[model samples]
Target: MTTVVVADDQGLVREGLELVLTARGCDVVGVAADGREAVEVVRRTLPDVVLMDVRMPVMDGIAATGEITRSGLPSRVLVLTTYDLDAYVYGALRAGADGFLLKATPPDRLVAGIDTVAAGEALLAPSLTRRLIEHHVRGPAPVVGRPAALAGLTEREHEVFLLIAQGLANDEIAEALVVSSATVKTHVNRILAKLGTRSRVELVVLAYESGAVRPGGA
Candidate 1:
């Protein structure tokens, strides 16, 4: 079963998410009312996925996400927020969140988002991707440091990374590159392994940071 940790300040929201996810056959391992507690729970439980709310008292989701990722935890974070245009989305993404979703998202999509991130895929909505790029561009250039983690990728793997950063799904990428979906999946797997990233969301961040693909280059 896919184990999940839910962190939200609101009791109702947390409970509702837990109920919905559990009903979908996911294991709701734990829930936290604040970011700090959430981080602690994650450290102890090591759940497969974390459904994190962006706003919380004592170390908001962004900071917790950074800490969780820097600590090299096994869990993937999926950020939940009420404001679509909130600047925190970009921060959380840079902090290593695997995906961002609106709190009002439908139950089916929310469940799918969890599964997507669990499968090492990024879950940015098509509409949200454009906004995310715009948000990043409007902010500072994020220091643009190159990490040696990207050194192991092959040319085709690099191509796949660019396509993924552009928000192309596996099928679309396969069609674009004239390769089978299975081949695209293989390339993506290699990309993730070489970069030491848990999901495609991290790949997108690396792609932008490496200048392999620009924000509007999509």
Candidate 2:
């Protein structure tokens, strides 16, 4: 069963999420009222996933997510917030949140999101993904350079990274490159290993932060 820690400022929200996750067969290992407490609980329990709220006292979810991710812990963070603003989405993903879903999501989808993040894949709300694409095409040219870590990637890996960074699905990437899906998957795995990212969302963040794709296309 998936193990999870629910972190939200409101007591009722915490209780509600705990109940929902529990009923879905997830092991609700712990719940915290704030980000700091959430971080502490996660470090102590080392659960598979953390359901973190964007806004909380002591430290916000973004910072807490950073703390957990940078700690080298095995836990993945899933941003479970009411807000779906671009700022929050960017902040959470850049801070290493493996998934981002609005609280208005149905319980079944929320549980599926937990499973997605637990399996080390990304789960973004459809609207959030749409917003990202819109901003990518219209947002201002951010002043940033390609990350030096990318130098470690092979030529094929770099090509794969660029495509995945633009939010293409694995099969889409394969079709674009005229390669098998398994080949694309292998390239993706190598890119992740070389870049030291845990999820594809991190890749999207890096691409945007580095201005690697630009406003038009790669």
Candidate 3:
């Protein structure tokens, strides 16, 4: 069973998330009412997933998520937020959150999102993903050059990364590139390896950062 820790300043929200996750066969390993405590519990429990609220006091989810990731813990964080436009969402992602989910999401989607993140995949809704892309695109470009990371990718691998950043799934990428789905998967794997990223979410970040693709720019 996947183990999860729910962290929210609101007791009711924590309890509700715990109940739903537990009913779905996820072990609710711990609960915390503040970000500091959440970070401590995550370090101790090494849970498979952390359901973190973005606006908690005493560190807040963005800082907590950063701590958890930098600690080299095995847990993946799934940020919970009531506001879709929360600025903390971008920081949390940069800090290595595996996914983000709106608190208003249905219970079933909540459970599925937990499972998805625990499995080392991101679960941002497509709309939220687009919003994140738009946000980053609107910002001034950073001075950092593309990491030497992209050096290891083959030409086809670069193509795959661009398609993924365009929000195409494996099958859709296959169709777009006129290749088989298996071939697309292989290209995706190579892209991830070359980019030194852990998930597709990071791939999206890198793609935007590298200016390989941009919001409203083809």
How does each model score on TM-score?
A: 0.71, 0.70, 0.73
Q: Per-residue lDDT for 182 in model 2?
A: 76
Error of 2 at 215 (Å): 12
lDDT of 1 by residue, 1-218 (tens): 88999999999999999999999999999999998999999999999999999889997998999999999999999998887765776788789998888888899878878887887777786557767566566666655655676667778887888888887777678999999977998898888878888766566666676666676574
Identify the candidate with maximal TM-score.
3
Q: In candidate 1, residue 109 scores what lDDT? A: 79
Candidate lDDT values, in order? 0.83, 0.85, 0.82
**Local lDDT at 69 for model 1:** 94
Quick one: ranking by lDDT, best first?
2, 1, 3
Model 2 ranges with Cα > 4 A deviation: 139-199, 202-218
| Residue-by-residue lDDT tens digits, candidate 2, 1-218 | 99999999999999999899899899999999888999899999999999999999999999999999999999999998999899999998889888899999999888877886787777787668667866764656655677788878888888888887666766667899999977987888788888888777667767776777753566
- Candidate closer to the true structure by lDDT (higher is better), 1 or 3: 1
Question: Candidate 3 — what's its lDDT?
Answer: 0.82
Q: Candidate 1, which ten residues in sequence have the lowest lDDT sum?
A: 137-146
Number of clashing pairs per prediction, in order? 0, 0, 0
TM-score, model 2 to reference: 0.70
Top candidate (lDDT): 2
